[model samples]
Target: MRIYQFLHNAFLFAASRMQAAGLEGRKEEQRLWIQVNAYRDFIMATGQVYLFEDYLAGVAPTSRPHVSTALGARPDTTSQRVMALLLKAFDETPEPEQKQSVSLLIHQVNFIADTGQLEACEDYIHNRLDYAPLAIAHFTTREEAEAWLMGPAEPPSPADILIGDEYYTAVYSREDNVRFMSRDYVIEPYIEELAAEGIPPTAPAFETRAEAEECLKSHPASPFDFVSIAGEHYLAVHHKRLNRHTLHPVASTLTQWEEQKRVVEREEARYAAMNTEGEDEES
Candidate 1:
């Protein structure tokens, strides 16, 4: 994700949460207020906070094609106007099973921009454009901002630690401050148990499946192989460009684990050879 988009999305989420906090009670409202203020202080410190007008002018050219076609014809189209059109289009769209106009609009914005222009727009949003609504609070020093953000500190407990070297899913118990690792995908019960005890889930980390169908965003290319142990298998997912391989278990029976080892070695060799050929060509 681009930094600009990430910030914008985060701000929206925070704003929504803040508005919701009002009805939840004083404590919840105060907590949300502090968090929002801290975030705003952090934004102000970055010195990249943008005003809406400046942001529109800066990214408009690149973003224009991704918006409504009629917007292209107008000389005075503003970001607010574009947003209203998008919202209206989203609202008028049919159900999820049908062709979604909102989905199409999202895809257009997400995938159609030229890479150079996208990067330039992101940089412009970060350094030059205006996002003033996000940064409502100010702090004099980094330490002051950090201290204010952290608020009163509690006594530290034992740091959370992963239980073992290998696992498919891990869950942390705050009561014991221990992370339980498992080879199986049965993590939901543990999570529910924790939530019942008032310990909300931290971010979840799951091992990517080594199978042909199941994959990770990091390693897109599939049909992976794995090292089969006594009965278990660990995947051999390799990235040819990076000359790197990730190991994870997959419950598939196609090739021997020995074949996966050979495949990893082959991928490394191919990448090395390509680099060598490129260097030779340059010379």
Candidate 2:
């Protein structure tokens, strides 16, 4: 988008320069005019209209060398040099419409870049061709252009996760504060219960009652407890809330548990509504 804007403005500046030169009867030196004409022909013939869009879409330019040529050959002089180039280019082909288009472009470029040379170009074009240059506000520098040509400071990546001292300390304290499980619970009986409930067993069992107890406490419903017991390994579970019981199942194989809960809730609601209706009729 910015490239298009810049190009559009540059063309306008070129037009203005041509208009000024015409008015003043200032003929460009023959050799310079020839060069400008050739350059303009090359641009008009090969310029990609959607170069910026292609770049953004990750599409490589068909002619890489052309890209370098376009940007690298950018004229350093004021808008006059730009317009002279366009006029010389237009004269070679002698396309009336193309000349007019280039003239208009020069006017636009002059307005955007706010270069003084545009006034001279505009005067030349109007005096010679009886065409008035369109009045345009001066172009201000676009911030995007600056940033693109000169990159900004790097920003940190979103996925970076930084663990602070407080977080480390909390985790460390939790692990350190845990007591050995062997001293608190029986491992063999727990494993037997788990096996009766159809839990699969594991190997490389806990070596001592304390080790088994710690494993059980860490992962209370794990199938490893059964393996530990069958292997004659001691086991333990956390004693802090060992006796506390909850009515809900420890684990469920059903994937639609939430849906099932909702269905049950709906059924209960329907029954309550029917009961309420019957009581009302009785009253």
Candidate 3:
């Protein structure tokens, strides 16, 4: 189920990116765009988008290599991740000023809940009047907020759980600490650099561009070497007579690396199952 969801999300992300790139009108892309969004809407209606994204983040790599052509962009920090959920919920990218408002609102909601003030409300925050921001941030009406808060006693969304020290810091500082350390990061080939590394692509391909860049920066290397393919980063290890790099997503980051691993594992399991079935048929 997890793997299925992950692949579904990849499709979701790809469709959205394609739509954003203005390819939505094409026949195949059009069908995909509509279906992806319809499915996304279903997921959102269930309020499980946050959980899905969180799970995806956990299984995906955290690093972004300087060069790697791949699809998708993972939010690097908890706040960006949380903000992404909110953006989807709102169905619009908040303007810069509006983003600040949303950021502040998230911090405020987290604060109200953490200080035990949320418990003191005794009903809906609408009743408290002082906590109107919480209601406004969540539900459209104070009554709605009141009912949900007073009834299930659960936060309106699972994303609320991701609000923590790291998230709050990003909100307050207006900066995510998770960033590339190498400002001058570049991937120039070895002295005998060819237009392309003739080696068959064997290294694990990082699925997302953001994860590849992170891996490029954080994945430690002796004398720190890598090769670039259409701007994607991959670690280069000297092999045979080739100075070419076999670019793969770094294992340490594990975003696409994990996905690739999962794919291979699933294939192996399927192969084993097929073999077992053959043996049974022989019997």
Model 2: ten consecutive residues of lowest lDDT: 164-173
The models' CA-based lDDT, in order, is 0.36, 0.35, 0.35
Clash totals for all candidate models: 8, 30, 22
Off by over 4 Å in 1: 1-58, 61-66, 70-231, 235-246, 249-283
Residues 133-190, model 1: lDDT tens digits: 1121233444443343345532111111111212122232334444332333222232
Q: RMSD to native for every prediction?
A: 24.5, 30.4, 21.8
**Residue by residue across 1-283, what tens digits does model 2's lDDT show?**
4434544554554455556666677666433333333332222222222332233345232311111222223455434455555445555535555554554343333232332333343333334223111111111233332232234432111111112100001010112332111111122233345435664445336555456445555465322323344354222222221221111121321223445557879999999999999999999
Error of 2 at 132 (Å): 31
What's the distance in Å from true for residue 23, model 2? 0.4
Off by over 4 Å in 2: 29-41, 47-283
Give me the candidate number with maximum TM-score: 3
Question: TM-score for all predictions?
Answer: 0.19, 0.18, 0.20
